[model samples]
Target: MSGPGSAVLAQLLAQSAGQGADLLALRAIAEEAGDLAAGRALARLGLEDAQAAKDMAELRELLAAWRAAKKSLWKAVLGWIVKMALVLMLAGLAVKLRLWELLE
Candidate 1:
């Protein structure tokens, strides 16, 4: 009943029961309730500090760097696999064509 929203709700109920309701008072109470709810939500998300935005940006940058490193590593591995396949194919062609005897 002490909370702003509850107080406003109680006032509404009182008005319904024939008491005169003040529009500004009800509006102020509702605004206070909305502000309190927003504050609580920010606190719950751990973003109530001045440094929270900076911390979030750093985390995003770290994630992007990690993803780039993983992509580069995969590309390098694929390049090596392709090179090995080419070497093997050339070796098999040389053996079939008796090209080694030509070098003697």
Candidate 2:
């Protein structure tokens, strides 16, 4: 009830109010039409029920959990790769210095 259509309806209601008792029917029709439009819009948006808020909240939480899991998975993979790289570097250095021969 805050857009151009509502504004026009408000203006029409005001004009009808000043026109006299004969326009009361027109006023009632306008109000009914506004209510019907609002109801239809709510229906279209699938938000006509009390559970809509709870459903939206659950969806948001599910999305956040998915994002968190994805982030942690990437972090684990990167950490593993880094650890492997470090181990390989250390092994390469030991081979270059012939450290295995010392143990032989």
Candidate 3:
């Protein structure tokens, strides 16, 4: 006989057809399947919910870290490019005035 969790999963899957299920919902269903296969129930469902929450929290933290790193990298690259351009411009002016030959 199917359990309450199976009923819930079936309903969620039906409702989510074509649009794709939410990550949390899919996690819950996967946990439910494991528990059902193992002949267990509520405990596994609760554990699955906790796991899903933890996963979401971790994902958010990672995304924030990535964004911060990307911003920092872009800033550093832009600063380096600006500095290099200025150095090249100065070098060009020095060469035009024969300053480079004097140093040689």
Candidate 4:
């Protein structure tokens, strides 16, 4: 059955059923023959590859979200520092002007 056509392979596959056939070997042969079984196997492989790619994409998205959150946290902390500095400056100005003496 060297270089058998797809139709012949299909016929053989149909005939081989329940005859204790080695389906793995037949699948390999079908791959060489470019038969329907090979097409099915390749479709399964394609689905697996697509799933892997989707997982990678999700991981990348998670990483991007983490980076954005880190950047936002730094910005909030920096803003807090500026606000604290401004408050301290205002208090120092009041003390310099002797405004505290009026509180007595």
Per-residue error at 69 for model 4, in Å? Answer: 0.3
TM-score between candidate 4 and the true structure: 0.51
Off by over 4 Å in 1: 1-38
* Order by lDDT, highest first: 2, 1, 4, 3
Structural similarity to truth (TM-score) of each candidate = 0.60, 0.60, 0.50, 0.51
Top model by lDDT, which number? 2
Instruction: List the lowest-lDDT window of 10 residues for candidate 2.
Output: 19-28
Off by over 4 Å in 3: 1-48
Report the alpha-carbon TM-score of model 2 versus the true structure.
Answer: 0.60
State the lDDT of candidate 1 residue by residue for 1-104, as single tens digits: 68896777777756754655666676677679879998899999998899988999999999999999999999999999999999999999999999999999
**Given candidate 3, what's the lDDT at residue 92?**
94
Off by over 4 Å in 2: 1-42
Instruction: Please provide, for model 2 over 3-30, each residue's C-alpha lDDT reduced to its tens digit, 9 standing for 90 to 100.
Output: 9977887787778778764577876787
lDDT of 4 by residue, 1-104 (tens): 55567568767776775587887787687677666656678678664454766877898999999999999999999999999999999999999999999999
Cand. 1 TM to true fold: 0.60
- The local lDDT score (0 to 100) that residue 77 gets in candidate 4 is 100
